[model samples]
Target: MHTPADSAVAIQGLHKKFKESHALCGVDLQVRQGEVLGLLGPNGAGKTTLVKILTTLLKPDSGHVLVNGWNVTADPEKIRSTIGMAGQYSTVDGLLTGFENLYLIAKLRGVGRRTARRNAEDLLARFRLSGVAGRPAGTYSGGMRRRLDLAAALVGSPPLVVLDEPTTGLDPESRLDTWDAVGELVAGGTTILLTTQYLEEADRLADRITVIDAGRVVADGTSDELKAAAGNRLVVCVAEDHQLDAAARAAARATGVTPMVDRRARRVEAAASDGPAALGRALTALEDEGVQVLEIGLSRSTLDDVFLGLTGRARHRAA
Candidate 1:
């Protein structure tokens, strides 16, 4: 039996398909209690399908999914009782006022009338929606609607929360607001499973990340770990038009790697195993070759680089 001290969400040999399109293929993952696990993939990578199965909205064709020690298929009701979810799109009722929406959910969850009212008010305040709590949800901006949707999900104070692209289509400020709200939830001991297209969001929020590609698990690790797996850092140098070839040769010699020259950017870049030490050597080589450096910098692999390295394609590339 799983416990709160163990995995909050676990899947083994999971597979799902819709007619000819395979959504998940032999997928396996575990989200530890009180930890944020980011699910990342390109479009059609089955992120939404996985979230649906966990929330009891969809049944997996083949797999074992356990939520807080309860089998998803065998005890869906029990699983639902422990999870809160906010999807990519807002689930808020357009005609209902913000406070009314939250109150309705609280009441449905068997909260007392007085406690429901208090919870509704507190949620509105927490989401910064109190000023317009009486207004119809349809009248709110995209950001406000998202905040309300997330607040509604938290009305029962569930121990597990599933957030699927919760910050999609929000302004920068509102995205940060949602990030702060997520942090608060984690602080209160909620385990989160987040699916997002935003690498920076995953970097900032998730303790670990699972990346899927072509309906299969391609990579899983902490941000730094994945970045490290993407291979060595690179030092890039831009040279004056006449010195471009010379700089490229110098960089290749310094790093002992083939250099890629960007004609449009007037830049030359080569992988460097020694990071700053490689940069020092490259600068010396450039000076020896009489290459006039316009700009020079060392850059480590980012999550994007890691994703591309594993998937053989960029995240925005359609599956």
Candidate 2:
């Protein structure tokens, strides 16, 4: 049972270092009870390190972490008991059946033998893995294994669950199924702290988001709030391959900011306060200059835009 006022997780001035790399630098965050907080950052941005610290798997060199009002350092054992974690890799044993894997976790969580069996079976059915419960986990597809891993995390019925890139390798359908499961857990009043590189996933699942770059928090807010802070609308236009430079110039003149040109894509992208009107002006200007427009549209600012603005780089590898 968690009180509304009791924060699910709280960290203050958290710092960690490995060799010369500063993994976390003066990081501070809080996740309210029953809320889903998304941690977004590029690789080497300290998202996983923060999750590890909160889950009591690693200790910060300085600062404090409190989970359910218990200090992580002073009450590590208690914190571990209250928290469940599923990392990027599935932890299901390849040699064991899905049911056996879940059964082992239930027993480890102190459930009686009969209860463990019942719990394992129920979880398998709930995750829609009962059909393959007897099959060795090694034979499971990527999506099935991910579902099993998530199911195992719930064996303890922990109040808080930390998911670090839980949907990294799943197909679109699998990701949607996983999202539904997460929603169901949240609806049941479980607090979740999710770390992911997928902006769309964060937008879909998080109540609040914290964006970290170079080991420090660069932004924190809801998805819409962060996007608003990133500035304004973006207008993208594709032109004939040979006319890209002229189109870029036209866009710059219309928007009063130099547009970014992607020669390979024959596209020019620029930001503007009023995207639709700006795009229309740019298009008209381009046509006046004898430049043929292929396509044009105004796009809402996204978390990716926020990351690029703050970090001076894209959050993920270029597609």
Of candidate 2, the 10-residue stretch with the lowest lDDT total is: 231-240
Off by over 4 Å in 2: 1-4, 234-243, 262-267, 273-298, 317-319
User: Which parts of model 1 are misplaced by more than 4 Å?
Assistant: 1-5, 249-266, 273-290, 293-298, 317-319
Residue-wise C-alpha lDDT for candidate 1, range 154-250, written one tens digit per residue: 9889988999988877888888888988887878888899998777888999999999887899999999998877666555556467788998899
Residue 263, candidate 2: C-alpha displacement in angstroms: 6.3
Please state the error at residue 4 of candidate 1 in Å: 7.0
Give each prediction's root-mean-square deviation over alpha carbons: 2.9, 3.3
In model 1, what lDDT does residue 35 have?
93
Query: Model 1 — TM-score against the truth?
Result: 0.89
Model 2 residue 296 lDDT score:
75
Best by lDDT: 1
